[model samples]
Target: MCNKHLMVVLIILAFDLAVATDSGLETTQAGGGLENRPQRDVSCRNHQEYPHDNICCLSCPAGSYVKSACTSAHERGTCENCDFDTYTEHDNGLLQCLKCTKCRPDQEIVARCTNTQNTECQCKAGRFCAPDQACEICKKCTICKDDEVKVRNCTTISNTECKRQLSTSSNKSGAVAAVLVLIAGSTVIVAFLKRKKKFVGEQDSQNPSEMEKVVVDSGSGLSDEEMQNKLNGRLYDSPLLEQAQAVGQQALANKEKETKQGNSFTSTAHSSPASLPTLPSAPLPAPYPHPRPVSPSHPNTRDDDLPRKKLVPLNGDKSLTDCFSYFEEVDVHFHNRFFRRIGLNDNAIKNRENLQPEDRVHQLLNVWLEKVGMEASINDLIAALLHLNQRLSAENIIAKAISEGHFEYEGKQPRDESQL
Candidate 1:
């Protein structure tokens, strides 16, 4: 019994060794399914694909084109599509690397839009055939008056046609053609009338053979008087309406003729009759030297033909330096000037006007500060002066600033408006 137990234990040890060997083989062998070359973290994602996913370029197939390019070599944006007008073939490994169709001058297309395919093409219904022109549709034929020339012919895709009657031939040929047309029209009318009558009256009573004769013969099936009456009615009853229509038609034909001649040499779009005329362009505005200042207070009026009055630069007067004194003394000087203008009485002026020269004096100081490029430091005073009348005397502003404790305007080594 002891020997048997020893053999059993040895067998168990051998089985365990075989199992470990098999696991090792599976890990390193190619046929081991997951047998490895290298190991990596499964949670790690590719960083280059931040915005886009699935980073492989697919090839383009034949007969279609790409309209757009991929955002990057890795990130594919939506593909631009092609219609019947364009074509592409080949495994375009991209959404946007497609092709547009090559259309002949006379050809046009109707398309079904798509991202990855070519649209379809068919002949336009109204287009005329052009030799060497790959046309999808034919344009309708234009009808012109006998004396008219076709300045521009219509194509199947477009409705515009130009025609004009340059001159009429004076001869019997024109009259003959007109007469023949009238006679043919009258005959058709008479025949229709006769057929109607015969179908209603004689056919009701006659045998089939006799009814056939009735159907064939009549005074053109209508009386001569009836034909004349219809013609007269058309000519006399609607003359005004017909004349107006004819005039309008003539005007349109003339305009179309002119347009065609114009476009033969020049290629461009014309907006409309009311569009502004194309004149020689003025010189471009330069960025520097500044633009003209549009003053709010304009003089009363001027005449178109009168010579323009130029504004000579108002250079600061040399004496303006002495005139910079402000506050009490400055006030006394401008006070005399204001009353002199107002006829010495406040009642002479408007009811609520401020008579104190100091009010505007401080404003002027601000302007002077701003002119010297110190506006950022004294913007408030400058702004106030901007609203005041330009005619206000300068001395008054100094007085107001001094009295208001804004500055000492009395005796100072300062430059006048000119010197400053």
Candidate 2:
């Protein structure tokens, strides 16, 4: 039974080996057929199609042109350099090189063309290219406004840039307005000063007695007895009444003496010329000094022919300073006018006038202190006085007052009137 089993196994193994040999023979035959059969040329499929020597072939690379075709299939063609101004961007089988692009009128060549590349173009100067628009054509730059200034000039790649003119007209207008205001202010000040001066002059010229008469007339509704009582009281207390009384006494004595003299002269005249005492004749009066010599041609020369009076300096004795000192003893109203004449404001004078007469000087000093600050000094006061063209007497009064330390000051000194 073992021998029979062994024989069957041997038969099964031989059959299996024969089958495997047949499969191997079939695979080898197939492989041999594939290797021996004519292979398809894949070179033409992978590369650009080109005709060479009546057969297909690979085309030439960039930067060069085909000079001649290859002699066989799947071979490269003979290539040569492209001419200047001509180009081919890719591997081509073209018979001739392509012509390079020309720059437009508004464009310029930035880079020259090569066999492997085309020409590069840019906008010309004073022009620009917009990326949003077709770059085939360039546009002109925009102009700036008349009132605008150029912040950046136009360039081939950028448009013009501008900015508005700043502060020119506004500054000019401001300066003009300031000048006009100054002129108007000065005119108003001058007019006020003139009017005040005229009013003060009129007040100064009126007699105190006349002013009293006007006052009494305004109160005319009083009874006669009341009026007489008021006049008696005023006459006893008034200095003007004392002066009038003294004048009346002197006039009565002169009249009595004149009457006695007249009677004596008549009696002497009756006694005859021989009785009159002989008197020495007085020497002839001396010829007048500084007699103006009349011109021969001016036969009708008179005393009026003398030269006109010479103009004096403003600071001389004849100027307003001589009159300004008179205000010291005058009424408060006159003092107010004096302050205004010297450049103090009316409101300040009014305030000062409201104070007691003894305190008026202190008030004036305070006003000056406010205007000039703490730097008010003797020198500064002198400068102000000189600017006003005051006389020596007025200057002395101020100097004395300052020396006595009647007022205090600090800070910067006062400037001249022109600077003010």
Candidate 3:
């Protein structure tokens, strides 16, 4: 029985060895099959290649598309040109090119679509669009108000920008304040001067003997008899006498001017002075060196019942030009007639009609200055306004001219000149 058991055990061992060898052969066959089979899709260099059939194929170039994918690894694909109105903007592995963008009705084409680029568009003039936001539609540009000024015009990327105009009312108020201050200062100065004069007058009114003794005491190199002669004649300068003399001189000048005007009118009516060829009369002396002061009680202080303020320019042509803005106060209805009087032609005036009223006034005044050359004067413009019956405008302009220091009222000769 033991011998039988040993043979059985040997048989069993041989059977187990055969089962082990068979299992080993099956495992080796399965490993070999796995090694020979295709792998799963692997990672690709995205810029250079794309995956197809579990392999990486080289990508097509710009302006073209992949008509057929590469069958092998690391190989180029079959590429075809992009169709019209379509684009492939970069090296791509796409089935077909993308459709080009269509600009809206409000937009203008900046660049047309090409194989490698898409269309570019922008809003037309008088319109705008923001680039950062989706441009579903363009927007209308803004218009500035009458009191506002244009800072920048509208463009495709930016809307119109405006700035509020500086108020002319403020300027007028400031000018008025300056005038008040000046008037107040003048009043103070005049009061001080009057007080000083009063003191002198009181001293002058002393007893005659006292006055004579004081004059003798003075260190003047003259005899008492000569000094007495001076006191008797009141040779000391008198303000009242000087003022009366000035009034008389001004009246004489006006009478002379009127007489000349009358003679010129009468002569012209009878016959042309140029044609008559008469001998030239003596040149009239220059009118009184200063203008007459305005006083309702004084008959010679006015011209034709119109209050006159003599305006002497501070800077010649510059003063005239500086006063141009004052003309804006002129009545709108009288603009054409007023400028025409200043020698502006219909065309010259019409050319500036589109400008704002103030701007038109300024521009046309410059044109007038150019035409009149150095002979251009604010006085002439003022006279023209007066002729047009724009008396209020003329007055306002004159006041502005004087208050702004472009001109000064030549009311009196300097004190030193009067003394001489």
Candidate 4:
């Protein structure tokens, strides 16, 4: 019975060992399957990438788009060039390039789109928008009110700035003080006139001949002939003389009116006219100091006269300065040439190079004005434009000057007298 129990134990041990060996073979087969399958949750270097079949594929460089995914790890995908009007700004794993931005009607293109970079745009002339703010649309530039003055012109990234005008109040105060001074002066003059009349009457009663020998109250000691001449001069310069002149002018106007009436009545009664109204002679054209030279390009321009119209300032020097803003319309390509033609030196123009085109034009113009002093005129600027064959800009500036009341065509007055 002991020998039978030992045989049974040996058989059971062999069976247990065989079962453990089959289980080990199955585990080995499962481990081999895992090695052949694609990786999951794999780590990749920090760059641009895309996942394909549980594997990370490196992205294409800028200006390109991924055409295909990599077949294996540690490899890049196929890439193709971006089409026109499309761009990829940086290394991207995108299947297609991004579409380029289009500038709005109110905006202008600053930089065109390329495969490597997107388009850049900004507000056009006379408009602005802040970059930090949500720029749904560009805004119209602010025009300063009459009671305000422009501090800075509008730029693409900033709007126009204005400040309250200070000169208006100062002018009002000065006018009020001037009126008060005039009133006080009139009072003193009236008192002196009364006292002089009384003294003259007392002197005349004493002796008519001795009146000439008496010293005059005038600050200067003078001979009899000199005092008589001074008295005659005062009478000629007095308000009474002005009143007499006004009366004479009024009588002349009435006589002219009567003459017109007579002429009208005579013309009504007779076939022949009594008198024809005298026509005023035409005014001769004013001569320009430096006439614009006739050019082959401008066949219509006359050698005797400049093709451009002459601009007469409405408010003298102030009008010339006021029209300085119009010069900002000058073409950027012709800036240096235009200014140089206007007599600005190279150093003067170079110094203002850092300023914006508009501000640079203004500074260079101001420098030219200072150098020319009272001789500065808009005509000089216009002539310079003509010299440079920039007639269109010259004409536009003249139109703006006339339209804005800063200037007018010679011999032609603006219909609105208040503007003058």
Q: Pick the candidate with the highest TM-score.
A: 4
lDDT of 3 by residue, 136-173 (tens): 99999887766677798788988879899886998799
Off by over 4 Å in 4: 1-40, 165-173, 177-420
Alpha-carbon lDDT of model 3 = 0.70
Pairs of residues clashing in candidate 3? none
The whole-model C-alpha lDDT of candidate 2 against the native structure comes to 0.55
Locate the minimum summed-lDDT window of 10 residues in model 2.
Answer: 207-216
Better of 2 and 4 by TM-score: 4
Q: What lDDT does each candidate get?
A: 0.40, 0.55, 0.70, 0.71
Regarding TM-score, does 1 or 3 come out ahead? 3
TM-score of 1: 0.17
What is the per-residue lDDT of model 2 for residues 36-123, given as tens digits with 9 covering 90 to 100? 2212333355348675544677788887778888887877878887889898888888777888888898898999888889998889
Compared with the true structure, the alpha-carbon lDDT of candidate 4 equals 0.71
* 3 against 4, candidate with superior TM-score: 4
Q: How well does each candidate superpose onto the true structure, as a TM-score? A: 0.17, 0.28, 0.36, 0.39
Identify the superior model by lDDT, candidate 2 or candidate 4.
4
**Candidate 1 local lDDT, 210-326, one digit each (tens):** 212112222333344334434433333333333344445565675676677686323433545444233212222222232112221432211211222211112223222223344
Runs in model 3 lying further than 4 Å from the true structure: 1-31, 35-41, 166-170, 173-420
Order the numbered candidates by lDDT, best leading.
4, 3, 2, 1
